[model samples]
Target: ADRPLLHGVSLRAAAGQTIAIVGQTGSGKSSLAQLVNRSYDASAGRVLVDGVDVRDWSLDALRSQIGKIEQDIFLFSRTIAENIAFGKPQAPRAEIEQAARDAQAHDFICEQKDGYDTVVGERGVTLSGGQRQRIALARAFLSNPRILILDDATSAIDSATEDDIQRALRRVQRGRTTILITHRLAQIRWADTIVVLDKGRVVAAGGHAELLRSSVHYRRIFSRFDAALPPAEPALAAA
Candidate 1:
């Protein structure tokens, strides 16, 4: 059967709000993301940005405003600075450095023999997985997209490094809309709204406590964090 990948699915995020999406491996999370940036068009329905459907926008005009940090980070055989500045090719040195610092990549970048000028191997093979992700994050920070998509962006970083990056994520996420897909309870805890998907549909959506109390689907997906969440608000729990 050629059923739609996503049906009756809708998500809305106020400008500068963070929306976290969580589901099992094939719950259409990434499909929903691809639609937003038009990596592939939806077979039906629409993805809107600023009340305008994405298909109505030009690729360059649309994509320049979106930043993405995925689990698989790709880099060319170029200087570290060039890779970070890939999107904004003419980014000033100071801005690039600041972005790197925010991504917690600056110290390691400076430690290289050529510092920012170090030429990484093809696809950043010279860098460790965590380093690659931080560099990808630095690129996103430098681009300063109005809509940021972080799909398992911190998976490669260690717990301690992740803590630093999490603080940075909290700080930099201000003033932009963020679409997050991650399993880390730490990052998911702070989202303005959490949308829970199941079998390609949105099964539930709400704050951590609300979902913990109300959504069986969400609870199963995030049961490990149940003890850590604050109890649901009395009124919300009663709903």
Candidate 2:
């Protein structure tokens, strides 16, 4: 049975803001993302983007207007340049390189023996997981859509690299709505609003601190993250 992935979940993301969806596995985070892009029509509610029903928008135009990065990155059998060009077929090579640099992919890309001309192996297996994800991000950046959705796109990346990707995403998200879907609380600390899901329903919605102090589920998850952080170093003694 196709269960309802979201139930009465009402939230908002204003222009130039970031909205993050955090929850445990099978808790509907990815479903909400797909719902927003109308990949799967809602069972009983509406999914709106920029004041318009997603279902009402023309399919090709709708997809082009919203950039999405999934956990599993997919690349074509063509050259890396062609894959990056897939987002905006007419995008100039300079623009593609700029986006790759922004994604922190240019250095590694150029280091490849074939450089931009390297053919991405089937499903991009020729590249590392992080490389493929960065390429995916570069493609999204090149699209320059009004909205961006990243569904656990950083799961395969290490913490330091994740931080770098977050920085890059911040620059790209300016003046655009960004939806980050993940189960990691640390990933949503910068979100304008964090929506917590449980049993396919919204159990909390607020900024990180507000939820940490007021929402039980949020507190529990945040406590786990807090515990994982390295202990602060003692202040250096005056010499």
Candidate 3:
């Protein structure tokens, strides 16, 4: 049974702005991201990039212009340098190192047995979840795409690691559009605009404070996140 994943969901993002999509599980957040990079073509309506239809662009050209990192990161069984240079194979070593630094991955990578030359096991099995994510981020940063999509990319990471990654993401997001599909309150708070999805539809859209005031659905979701936060920190109330 093929049901519509998104229904009449209309939204827009300005260049260099961050847009966060927040929702409960099965809310179609990932589906929306997939459509942006053309991983899944929309069954109806259209996706536009730079005011142009995504379908009109060549697949390679379209994908090359977008850098996407999902929760399930996939890294090859190769040296750290090789993996980072996957998108730009001819990139100089200096450029690769710069990208690693930008991803907050350089320090750990340098500590590895052979530094950047260390060969990872199949699917990066030798690396921890957080390390693999940083490597994936470094790969995306090396690509230097105009648009970045992060689909819960930091969910598996601990708070400290996620903070480092978020800082790196802030630097990489400059002069580019960023879409964050996540339920983490911290990540959602970073967006210039937050879109709330429920059952494949946009239930609300606005800034964090504005939605907190007007949308009960959003407040309810935030309440759950609030309850999970440390008692010393007044989560959404302070936001």
In candidate 2 the C-alpha lDDT for residue 167 amounts to: 70
lDDT tens digits by residue: candidate 2, 1-239: 86676788888788878999887778888888888777888878788777889889988889988898888888999899999889788988899999999988898899998999999889998887788888888998898888899898877776657776777767777788899886565568888999989878999998887776667777666556567733434445789
Q: Is candidate 2 or candidate 3 better by TM-score?
A: 3
For residues 1-239, write the lDDT of model 3, one tens digit per residue. Answer: 98998899999999989999988889899999999989879878999999999999999999999998888888889999999998899999999999999999999999999999999999889998889889888988899999999998887787668889878877787888999987778778878999999999999999987887777778777777777632232255544
Q: In candidate 3, what residue range of length 10 has the lowest lDDT sum?
A: 229-238
Worst 10 residues of 2 by lDDT: 227-236
Clashes of 3: 0
Candidate models: Cα lDDT each: 0.87, 0.82, 0.88
Error of 2 at 137 (Å): 1.3
How do all models score by TM-score? 0.92, 0.90, 0.92
Model 2 residue runs over 4 Å out of place are 229-239
TM-score of candidate 1 versus the correct structure, residues matched by position: 0.92
Error of 3 at 119 (Å): 0.6
Cand. 2 TM to true fold:
0.90
